[model samples]
Target: MNTAHSLAPSQVSNKARVLLPGARLGLLGGGQLGRMTALAARAMGYRIWTLDPQPDCPCAQVADHQLQASFADDAAARELARACDVVAYEFENVDLRLAQTIEQHGYLPQGSHLLAVTQQRLREKHAVAAAGVPVTAFRAVRTRRDLAAALAELGLPCVLKTTRGGYDGKGQWLLRSTADAARVPDAVFHGDAAVEPAGESDTALEAPLVAEAFVPFVAEVSVVVARTAQGDVVSFPPAENVHQDGILRFSIVPARLPQEVLRRAQKAAERVAVALDAVGLLAVEMFVTADGRVWFNELAPRPHNSGHYTQDACSTSQFEQFVRALCGLRLASPRLLSPVVMANILGEHLPAVMRHLPAWPGDAKLHLYGKAEAKPGRKMGHVNVLAPRLEEALELLRTLQVWGPLDLPAPRLSS
Candidate 1:
């Protein structure tokens, strides 16, 4: 049996009615992504019900109803399903059992199949490759011997990552040599990424670690694509991304790449969504190599950090598209309104951002998540600077010096 196959879209959407205004959107997880999506839903006159452990979570702040309960609480999960018309996910780390329960009790348009595959690196990779998208060569390592064998097969300078939950580079380590491999704890092979997850249950210890060949990527880009249950699809322009200390810091729109490469990135993203038979948003991250090939990196089946620019620069925000996809509505145009530079406001940069708030540029749009605490490396908010030209926007960010300069100027955009 093909492990990557998707249930037919017709089966998923046949019973779907156009969720009119006043519909209750059940949001799973309540980070900034949830908050933003909730805001979009409200703009369309839809009420939101958010389930998260934090009573004052960012999403809950805007949602019409807040269910402050643990994600593991089956009772609360059922309650959220029964109380809302459509339930959707905000992040990718949702428990499969929780999603399954929601699907059984509520209308989860995007089923748990993608979650089951994407929960683990091994399965996500298999699904992406099976979809005919190119990905870095990888091997599954469940034991120390598997690690050694995978290293031998892929060679040094690879990446060793836990198959389970980790974001912002938590579960991944760049293995430059055998010494690096030796540094990874044996527990990692057993499903603990050694990155110290908050709880044992947070780790998907049943799955193995994935040892992936490190690609010498020239640039990293992501495309946010949406598909409706009725088979409609649309992709936003690719955003060039830069990561610092394993966390994303910047996403530049109209990625300064060859036109062909940009098109390839969107096509690859659309391919993944079609192959997955996705019914909502899917963010496909890819690497543009020196050879001009765009290789699949990973995926997020919800709104992505890289697509944040769409909130300010596109004709339709990704959050709105996400809402549309969930309700089986016709997708709005994803036309680029301007070249934009989206810089993340890490906790370290929050003070400076606050200091300059009054002086923030007219062309810049600020979005801050209502988190009560701040620490180094935590994503506090983001600023999207728009301009007629990409260079002007990037230069504006440099002048602010809030986070320093763009990692690398897009050669063509600079010219």
Candidate 2:
């Protein structure tokens, strides 16, 4: 593994200069991550500009300027970069080439190499495994023959996922039987769901599918690590995550695990950050088996939903840490000030959430994304409930009763 300490002084010297207060910061995505990052940047006395397809995007509401455009618009990306001192992206799905283009016009502290590796699952898995992190067995499925071979090797109860443009449970399917395997088309396996057809650049679609063996783990956990341009690294405590229908439903901080397990998870996360030469935030998700084995599950090279508890529970929120890292500021301690539980508010829960809005206690901090419309399975907002004890926070979340009947079946937990 290539450690940050092994880099040459010249390589470190070439990094973008430290962006100070009053400088304008450009963000690539105007979703919740960008919105929160903008909020933090504004609080630090920096002007913010954002580019997103939605004119009324959440981040746009707080930004000094909003450039409404598609992620693939190279001209708009350059315009955003030219208008700001340094640029950062809140999501990983932004076009990798667009980021490279932005770098030519202005400083992109986070760099584009990590984004290129993370946008596709096949590449991401390979990167992680190459970094000496243990990952579940997986094979790239570019054709029906590949899928069949992977299935034969990995067996039933495995998962088939699109290599790119998948999040919050989109673009993946479970294969539990031969019938499930027979339903997938060869074209779907090879075509990228995120790429525009015959675009300005003839971007060939990479491997579009991946098949992985399913591990029946006791719990899912994640650690959010932030790295500065100077190679300083800091990470928050591991968060125990629970997902329902492939969407993260809740994150319990100070994950219920042995101290040894937590330490291992943290170390693995830090190693990933250093190996990727990550300059901003990177959230590493892992699975812990009943026997205490940890396996890499996924990687998000930006603010993560699992880290939402930090907004209310930590002295420095993840968004602030992200800004600090990008601007080359000293990283703050990611201490857990209090035990907390964060529950995602999906679109299905909005009605009940609004009806009980005034009933929530001060301990519960509600963050709505300011989206115009609510659809099934859409992440409309989240609520972080803090308490002196983890059990109390969990109880409060359970009794909140905001979430209605889900469209899909209840999430299956490991025995």
Candidate 3:
């Protein structure tokens, strides 16, 4: 197997003015994103070292070396840093302290400050808004009184979120009425969800949260952009995303949007990256309001779930872009290679539908995470198919004749 040190200097030397194929790349998270990164890196002649707590994490199964440890484990992170030339992140919720620990040994593209700030909703909103990008109206809630005040200011039908560790819909609450106040107890008990305070105890974890007046959006869309050390930047095609119960269900590429609106979305993403001096993939999620106005929703500094469709649809996938950026190489052009439809496979329906999944067309691209077990609403894999048009894709999906979602009964466990 190809290893980082076995590559020629052109491939793995960080001190070199330029990076070549076969470099050793270190990844901070070992989920599906890491697995995809390792696949792309290997295709480019690079090797991978991964850090994750799971012994059988999806990415660990394929990495050249896997350091099984918590994100907060400093000694293991140092060992991982020593094994790689440069480091990149997969998910945004990585411990800030862990990031700092790794930064001491090598480099983390997008930087610790970017992750430190963007990890929290209030700070992220403040930074994005300060950068002149539009965001939903929001206020910070520090206590029960603070929550009451933010509600008074932002009003009801708003979103309540902890500042630090929330993602994919976790650590968030929807407040529709006064009765929803009961949910506040969970956040207080959970502590600060978004921003982590320095020199603070984990027990006093509950800090200020953010409440935003939720906008009624027509659809959610995202643009994945990347920046390099040389200041080069590029954006992939916009994707129209659909969500259910706060998790992404489907992402359609070259999203069904007007030309002008598409341009606006790309511009908004580019604006944020430049403002942050961001040096890796930035997934900018936005709300295209019913009125056609585009509002910045949230930002993920690393590869994002919404951009997964790009793996099959784009000439340069986000994973490749990330590899290029973290290695300080010239950025690649982001262009759609085809019109595609991508659907997420959730375990919620997997048990009931596994028997029918094999019936899907052999041509469809099916990717399953090496997760050991399945649970309701858990993401198991995804399917991407290329077709002539969006309508055709949707039609093909319907005609595929799979059973689950609506009509299938709950699966029974075998003895």
Residue 200 of candidate 2: its Cα lDDT?
A: 30
Best by lDDT: 2
The stretch of ten residues in a row with the least summed lDDT in candidate 3 is 406-415
Report the C-alpha lDDT of model 2 over 1-415, residue by residue, as the tens digit: 1112334555453584788999999999999999999999999999999999998999999999999999989999999999999899999888887898987888998888888877878777877888899999998888888888999999888899988788987888899987898997656765656542221321333577889998888888899998888887889999988898999998987788877778888889888888888889999999988777789988998999999999999998999999999998888888789999898988898998998889888888999999989998998999999999988887777667785432222123344
Off by over 4 Å in 3: 1-17, 186-206, 401-415
Which residues of candidate 1, in runs, are more than 4 Å off?
A: 1-15, 194-206, 405-407, 411-415
Over all chains combined, what TM-score does candidate 3 have?
0.88
Give the clashing residue pairs of candidate 1, or none.
Answer: none
**Model 1 residue 211 lDDT score:** 88
lDDT of each: 0.84, 0.85, 0.75
Candidate 1 lDDT over residue span 109-184, tens digit each = 8878777766667778878999899999988777777888889999888998887787899888899988888898
Instruction: Give the per-residue lDDT digits (tens) of candidate 3, residues 53-168.
Output: 99989998889989999988889888877777788878878888877777788766556777766776666787788888899988767767777887888888888877777767
